[model samples]
Target chain A: MKVYNISFQIDPDLEFQWLEWMKNNFIPSLMSTKSFTENKFYQIKVNADQSPTYTLQLYCDNIELWQAYQELQANDHLKELQYTWGEKCYYFCTEMQIVN
Target chain B: MKVYNISFQIDPDLEFQWLEWMKNNFIPSLMSTKSFTENKFYQIKVNADQSPTYTLQLYCDNIELWQAYQELQANDHLKELQYTWGEKCYYFCTEMQIVN
Candidate 1:
């Protein structure tokens, strides 16, 4: 299986609103695509030098499926988020393989 | 190698300040312990129902070293964070085994 680890930097002032939007809209839309098998959201911790953020761990059967989701649907999803968050958010994606 | 994925939810209003703290204080403190082999931070993506966050992916030689870190020093680290963020932060930790 292939796993994608995605992180986001959100505006602290609008955190609750952003969470509501994601639960009501973003997650469902992505799950509905049929390419992903499972997805989990995580709340990050703030250390002495940084504020907290959010994480989405997506599991797919293979890299091809992940690529399909990205190439076919990610842009639209990203556009929607950009409209809502504007410049208050930043993110990165990493691919992982399970060994045990 | 064993990998630990740590995610945190921080106060958005204090993000920049927090980032500076992490870069200068928290991260340095952890690295000083000399147990973690490598570490990388990622800005998470926010979906419809979630807000942006941060992730710390730490690499080590094995689970024993990770355990040493937790039992030896994690509590102090956590306490420092508590002092800074109060109730505006949350986090989760996951262990991953690399396959490739």
Candidate 2:
């Protein structure tokens, strides 16, 4: 399996409200697409900045499926996030290969 | 559950051999301590440097167990890795809360 992770650092002021929105709206909308088999969300404990950091992990059967999601759905989802939060949230994506 | 992640960026020249050592020795030794419930290894697909990066995630029921492992076993394990590989490998640690 492959894990497609999107890690985000959000403005502290919007943390609570943003988290609720993500859980109730954003993540559900993404999952509805059925491109992933499993998903996990996490708060990475690092104090690099005043903003809080979190990661959303979406697991799929293979890279091809994830690539397909990227081609078909990723841009829309990301666009929505950017359009909603703007500078309040910043993110980076990483593709990880499960070793064991 | 909590994930204690150790992320390493290793000299590309030692990638193959070091991976073999980690899969066969380091990870197993860490597991033997039984401080964690589950573990996963991954290579984050990023090309920020000449070195290749990998992560070892150890899952435990809580932070206390991980703290115990850090107090009793972590140092020795890290020392062994350092003694064996020296400047060939560099790493950082992160503690994360599973949100989903």
Candidate 3:
């Protein structure tokens, strides 16, 4: 299986709105792509720090599916989010091949 | 090899200081543990978001080495960082058994 992790650094001022949008809209739209086998989201909390961090992980059977999802992001739906979130969000994509 | 990921959500107000400390202090101490085979740090950027996010990944030959590093964190050096960073930092540890 291949695991892909995408992390977001969010502005504290827009934390609530970001979470709401991600939960209600962003994630669902990604899921609709039907390319992922498992998906999970994490809300990271810093002890006394006020910074907002969130992680989205998707598990796919292979890189092909992931590539397909990436291609779909070209659509208008994902583009809208890209513009809405703008610079307030940053993400990194890593491909992991599980070895146990 | 075993791959471990630790992510931190940092306060924007403490961004520069935090980065400096991690680069100079926390990370060096982690390296001193002498258990990790490879270590990397990533500074994540969010487009318009003001939040700060960082990730630390350690590669080990086995879980035992990882456990040793965890044990070392109990020392005074690591604790000092824990106290200094306090609530300003958040982290998650995930173990990945690479399968290619």
Which model scores highest in TM-score?
Answer: 2
Candidate 1 global CA lDDT score: 0.74
| Top-down TM-score ranking | 2, 1, 3
**Candidate 1 deviant stretches above 4 angstroms:** B1-69, B72-100
Over B41-84, each residue of candidate 1 has an lDDT whose tens digit, in order, gives 76655554654477777778867777899898888887888888
Per-model CA lDDT versus the true structure: 0.74, 0.89, 0.69
Q: DockQ numbers for every candidate?
A: 0.04, 0.89, 0.05
Collision pairs in model 2: none
**By summed lDDT, which 10 consecutive residues of candidate 2 chain B come out lowest?**
B44-53
Residue by residue across A53-99, what tens digits does model 1's lDDT show?
77777778867878888888878887888887888777777665542
lDDT of 3 at A4: 63
> How many residue pairs clash in each candidate at the backbone level?
32, 0, 19
Candidate 2 Cα errors over 4 Å, as ranges: none
Candidate 3 residue spans exceeding 4 A from truth: A72-78, B1-100
Q: Candidate 3 — what's its lDDT? A: 0.69
- What's the residue-level lDDT of B66 in candidate 3? 70
Give the alpha carbon lDDT tens digit for every residue of A1-100 in model 2.
7888899999999999899989999899889988999888999987766589999989888677788898999989999999999999999888888875
